[model samples]
Target: MSIVKNDLADNSLNDPHRLLRNMIDQVPDYLFVKDLDCRFIVANEAVARIHGFESPDDLTGKNDFDLHDASSAARFSQIERQVIRTGVAMIGMEECVVDAASGKERWLSTSKVPLRSANDTVVGLIGISRDISARKRDDFLRDEQTAILEMIVVNSPLHAVLDRLVRLMERQLVGVYGSILLLDDGGTHLKHGAAPALSQEYCGAIDGLPIGPGAGSCGTAAWLGESVIVADIASDPLWKNYRDLASRHGLKSCWSAPVLSHDGIVLGTFALYSARVRHPEPAEINLTQIATRIAAIAIERKHAEDKIRHMAYHDMLTGLPNRSLLTDRLTQAMLQTKRHNPWVSVLFVDLDNFKFVNDSLGHTAGDELLKTVARRMENCIQPTDAAVRMGGDEFVILLTDLPENTDAIAAAMHKIRAAILEPMIIRGREFHITCSIGIATYPQDGTDAETLIANADIAMYKAKEAGRDGFRFFTPELNIKAHERLALHDGIRRGIAQSEFHLLYQPQVELEFGRIFAVEALVRWNHPQLGLINPNEFIPLAEETGLIVPLGEWVLYEACKQNKRWQDAGFEPITMCVNVSARQFHDQNWTSRVMHALGETELDAKCLELELTESLVMRDVNEVIATMEELRKVGVSFAIDDFGTGYSNLSALKSLPVSRLKIDRSFLRNLVEDDDDKTITAAVISLAQKLNMKVIAEGVETHEQLTFLRENHCDEVQGHLFSEAVSSTEIGKLLQNQQSRSGLAPA
Candidate 1:
């Protein structure tokens, strides 16, 4: 289209300039012409609308600088100057432009072409621009959404992403500021997640906002798990508590959407606040929903990550740090030693007799006891110290910055003991549990966590060996003993497998008839290198290492075999007794094993007896009774060994299918010297007679002790007074002598 001469004055239909103006006015792309001096000569309707002009004529005589910001105007001038000077067109130049009509930031894709006179000289510039502001805004929002997605995927801190999200939301919607509120851990309260545009005081006032009905926009949204739009906060009942606070912060209209996980559980809320009182438009509501979904993803992902982290570092049962976390913390503590030179003490604790609780009261009560003890242990230490359950009845305390003197360590150990021994009532029964603790200090007990923990464990064993209910510090001697104990444990394991364990039978004589009644088989380990190791030295260790189960089975089989050998050798078929450890008795299949042993040896079940300690029998009496009944059905008898030394439940004992009760040797050792021993011996005999069970006094060594037991009507005696625990051959000779003395001949 071209402008004709005298077109401004022409009234005819063939006015070229008027025709060009009419054509350009219908085009949506902005069209304008500028003279050599950069003055706007003509513009189309699109350009006029953008420039806030009523008509194309209103832009006439205006330069780019007059309509655009200085930077944009300068760039436009340079481009137009180049087009006018060089007759070159600049095409599709993207630029940030200030919209003259609304004074808003806009993006435009602009092209400038030179205008030529009839003489072929560059006269002015003609520019066509397409407003691309909406595309630019959409791209910006897309980037923001991408960033949010990255934050969720990479496990970035949730708050940082939410803060970025609210900022993006505020910038996207004019006259709207945004906030995000997250549900607290308990899911009963809302905490301020991010509110950059809102005042800190306003955020503080709304933080810890309870999630319930009528709890303002975000709180109510979270509580209801739905969107809540308040046209006017001043009048909305939901904002009654927060209206004044919002008014002070110049917030009026509020719209909120619950941030919900895919499972429909509310995680948080996304909200927008307007200074003006008005309902949210459809577009604003849609934005709120989009923001809420993003917020939900971030919140849920963070919660899941946190839960996983907690599970990794924490014990599920006691909620204390697990081995993994303990190792990590101990490593860190060791690292800190070089800089601060502080003492780091590791206390290894083993709960004494904890198995009794599990056996007697059930594991449920045992668990309660452990958790309660864990709490008490935590209370005994400083807040900076850590107490952790190192799995089942074993705990460790990491103490930092302790004194050089041993007093503090001793005091802490004492505190731990006292705390554990404090009477705990569980399942309607009171219990006093004891713990053996060992202490290992940094720099002295080795420099690393593993060494320190190992040493502490070594000391713990020392404490237990010292009779338990105590604590011991790691010493040089303990290290040697620890190594020896380890060797012993290995030896015991090998002995059981290699059949290195042998039995020593002590004949139990019928006091009235002077005939052999039974022989108790005592296990003796003939270690190839260590020689004959007494049961006292290794029996407890076997129990601790869970070696007792297999070892006990070996003893049972060996005792049954030896008894069968005696019977085959034409000796009396007296009952052969085997001692059972608590660990062996607690084995669910113990009765079956005994039957198997008897079956394998082909020994008469009537000639076999299983001896259990008072404590072991009292633990889970019902289970003991059931086991005893099963054995009794096969004619196997039961004996309560170490009778008065353990906490025996007399009532439960009455229900046991026991054939004999053996008085503990400790009572008999002082039988003549102590009146208490004499009285206990007499009382046991009387009780056994009343229950139709024979009483046997063990460890009898002198005439006075044997006379006391006989006068007390003890049905049998098994001690040095007759013979010590001797070899099978020695016992065979003694059995022969006893049978001969009783006027019987051994084939």
Candidate 2:
């Protein structure tokens, strides 16, 4: 190339061919200049080389129609006409063309500009073209990848992430079709997720493919936890057996990569199949590895979520539904009952005296006992009914479709009681426990969850108050009594401050002599407005409201003081019997309370007898015996109050240290006429005599009952036949008169 002086001085303008030729040679893009008749006038070296020509001369003076197929020529003409008609440059026109001389297809991205003379007449066309085959192929790959990504994301719920990676490699690498085979639940089989598009029939045929060393490509990959390649499916042992099926579906080769969890547990395999025998490209292998990692994360996350949800609703201690889930179920059940107007019952159960067992036997034993109780409760209810543990020692049952009447509920309660009371052997020790049940019915007790629970709780407490190991229904009367108990609690507190309580004496006399043998000390509460209240009304109220401890102390102090006064007034010492409630009897300070009362009043312990009901003695015989022995050491005699009315075993009675058994007044009410009553009394008297224990016939109001008691040789008697429970002042007067008449009073 030679440079001229004019060209150097005015580089902007020069000979047209020289300027065009220089621009074409300097540009990296391929450029060509064509005349109006479509003959190539000039061509850049890059354009010549792009068409596999050795020199520009070979490309110049040649039209696209001479070098291209009709389809390519038509596309070129369309671009040239567009530029000439608009007199504008056509930018970035992409087309695929087959080189006429080389017979090879190449993609060209071309831009054409209209060439004109100085007078503004169209002279020719100038074109710029780039060999973009690589870019075009990459773009095609990206579009295919995007479509496959969407398909996997939408279809492969189990292996979407891994399936997409496999599909991407299959599209980007030639001669490859993809498959994702996940391990089945048994861990011995491979199940297809997304299979090769070309081998659909083959994949379907081996959908539930087995896994082993040489079962198949996917099976071998999963078994070895590595990649497996069958370069020729017909010859490789891994697919030797499946060669017929593969040949039928036009599959000749397969490659597989093991899909594994983060911990290296084989989850499945990612496989690719080829219609013609071939090896996997490096890009395909790389994508398979990436997909395996993603699959591991997704599968692990799903499994973790499921495990957590399972644990949240179950109790770890007993494998039962915990309080949270159980309550939710109960609320739903209540809603169903309300909507359907069906019968439903909620049972509130509390173990009877569980605290004692826990305290005496340590918490380990207590825990074991609770587990045992949970199992028994689960057995007691129907499958439709739910037995829920509301934490320690408390259980609630939601029962539906109960019988029309409350009898079924009662029967269920009894069954529950029986189940719980069955003896349990824990830590080589046989233990027996019972439960107190409170039942609240739908619509009758409450319609809502909270109201039903509250009513059930109230009824449960009522069961405890009525002496435990029993069941009670929620009733209006119980609610009234609960309110009255609250009122009495407040009243007792006020009474203690105002000194409104007093003691009365009920005379216990010998039926033969009409002489007083002992005096039963009873408590009286003067309510100021209500005049006087009997002990029966306030005593139980005091016990329930936990006011008995203080009230009982007051009674002991007042009774001992009264007894000492009568003795100081020269009347003979008479045994004063005081009723002890179960609550008071269970108090650890009871023995101390009695000793303090005796010391404070200077009264003899021999003259004081503590009366307890039959049920209290049967609760824990050994503990009761220990308590009785402690009291006996201080000269306090014992008596069983209202005997023959409870579940008292004859063997247990023989072992107790009680001095006398009081026949319940009901038996004596018609003792002379009713054969059953007479027989009961006779048996009691005979048993007492045989055991050398004294028998007291209480509530004897008539002389006929008195005569019958005398004939039966009953040891002592106390009732209306002698006198009613009277005030202390009247009791003192009667004692003085009796002492004077017997000539045993001071002169």
Candidate 3:
């Protein structure tokens, strides 16, 4: 509102001078009257105290330039002159001005009215201002926190968010610089998070300060998990170690608070440094607290998200890239191969007999062994290469930047095998392990991720079959085999479903009497298109594709049914032997399966014998024996087939509850000349008899071999000597012939 002509003379109160002065001084707001020269003609107590004066008389005749810094005083004089010259009243103008008391910026809601004389001529301005510094500071902090939290929720760049935070903190405190120092990944030293106000040289000097008691304010705060306030860096004992550095940077006072996560984890530190040596005010402390809380939220959220992604893409046991990561990297490598590296190799590395270790040493030690192997594989590869764990004991190493030479690839594969073969010390015992690696290269072993991995897997199995520890590259022939294997697997599945599979019985003759007392039921798949498919091809494929569980069940039930039929037909009673695959043997429900077949066929468990290979028995001897004992209790007997092959030491034989042992055909095929084979056969028979288990000989095709078996006192024999495999009706005829020759009854 404009001043009126009688505005200064309207009051008629008694003792007006002292009354008006006391009233103005007690208002708790700054009030003053300025002359045409912008000098203070009258001042109140609030105005005096704000300008660093004890009494209003001290500022009575002083100008704005005398009470404030030149910049602030000039701004004030310009605003007040407009009110005086235009005779206009400016209302509610918020402006920043220097506080002469603290030498810091303060905010004011100021209003100025032009004063007029009795003639209505403008004279000077009357100023009234209310201190709004605290309110403005709170509003600024609220707005900034909201903005930073929004950024954090949206997953903004961490450095950018923290930079804005540091600058916001610096804005509230005069001459105070702000920094946020993040703890390094190792949690040992500090790394720069944000330091927008600090000099580059100073920031670099303290970037990696290890957190400790006397390692400056930020470092000590981080180490102690508490706020550290060094009021005077030049003389404080906490800053004694860093005093020289502080002096070089003109930093005199510092306050630092540890930034802690919600779980009390130390994420970093928030620090405020002042150029002048002084204690921090309440406002400074409040900003430090708010800034640290916000920083903790930002850092902890980042760390939590990062940890989530890590767990998703990495194997839990070995901390290596899992299959998903393997596929991703393979795709990226394939895309980059033509532009960058001459070749990209995907090595399918599988540990040999990992299940044996896992069962023998317990899963705990097995996990330790896997972790050790993973580390060795990592060390064997370059930084550009990735070592991924593809579940269980399988791994894949992706190699980039390879020379197109076969020799170099061979060298790399050999190095990896050598590293893997080194003894790993786990849980206070040293153990040896080996890996079979299959190499599939870019532009040669198929182009896509799935095909390359598949080819490499095929090559790996081939290497395992070649020997225990070896490396082999994928060949075109291997792909053919792989495709054929896939076809056979599918065919066998369809064969079982469509009744294309039937049984052929090979008679196992009692050696001393020459009577057919038992027959081994072998499976034959008769495809409608390709004639009879070989068991030699499909058996292994069925096992590989996990179709053995169903196929073996069918074989078992069919064999028992055939044996029951023969007995029902008034033939001599005989044992029916069924070959069990390694996969089926390891199944948890395998015992139940055998019992179910016996019950369904109404066959005597006594006449049914399950034949397991020596390798399957040795895979996990304790578990195998436990299962064998369970079956043997129900009157079903077990036998070790292929006794001379695969883990054929005498140590595992004596404890097994086996009723018979079968010599593998490989030993019998060359027993006429190979002394080693003869010795092994004789030893196996002797070992079997000593364990009170009757032994049988397979592949005995000649009378000489028969004589050899008789010399060894073998209990039974089965081969082409009597017959190959025949049909059920032919088996019936063979059984009748045996009975006629021996003149035996159906007993």
User: Which prediction has the highest lDDT against the true structure?
Assistant: 3
Tell me how many clashing residue pairs each candidate has: 0, 1, 0
Q: Give every collision pair in model 1.
A: none
Question: Candidate 3 deviates by what RMSD?
Answer: 20.3
- For model 1, state the Cα shift of residue 385 in Å: 4.5
Worst 10 residues of 2 by lDDT: 738-747
Which residue runs does candidate 2 get wrong by more than 4 Å? Answer: 1-170, 173-177, 181-215, 232-253, 311-747
Higher-scoring candidate on TM-score, 2 or 3: 3
> What's each prediction's TM-score?
0.56, 0.42, 0.53
**lDDT digits (tens) for residues 620-705 of candidate 3:** 78889999999999999988898877865578778999999999999999899999988999988888898999989998788888
lDDT of candidate 1 over 1-747, digit per residue (tens): 246645644644467867787889999898888899889998899888887888988888989788877887898788788788889899999988667667788889989998889998888988899989889989999999998899889888888989999998888889999999888889999888999988899889888999899999888888888889999999999999889898998998999989989999988888999999999888788788889888888888888888878976787789999777887888888788778787889999999999999999988999999999999988889977899888789999998887667788888888888888989999899999998989899889888776788799999998999999988899988888578877888899898889889889887877887678788999889899988888899999998777899999998998999999988988778999899998798675788899899999999999998898998888678978988898899899999999998867788888899999999999988789899888988998999899999998888788888888778888888877677788999877876776566721211
What's the TM for model 2? 0.42
> Higher-lDDT candidate among 2 and 3?
3
Which residue segments of model 3 deviate by more than 4 Å?
Answer: 1-14, 30-129, 236-241, 327-342, 357-365, 418-434, 447-451, 464-470, 480-747
lDDT of residue 635 for candidate 3: 91
lDDT of 2 by residue, 1-747 (tens): 356766664775557876776777778778888877667888887777667788888977787787777887877877687777778888888878776456666788888888999999878888888889778767876675566455544544545555555666665666667777778778998877775465566667888888888888888888888888888999888887788988888889888888788788888887778888877777767766765665565555555655666666665566667666766777887777767777889999999988877888876788889888889888988998888776678788778877669888888888888999999988788988988889998878876775676678789998898999888899977777556655666899899889998877888876556678789988878998777887788877787555788888888888888889989988889888988887688765788888999999999999999998998898778889999999898899999999989868889889899999999998999888899998889889999879889999889888788778878889888877667888888888888888767521111
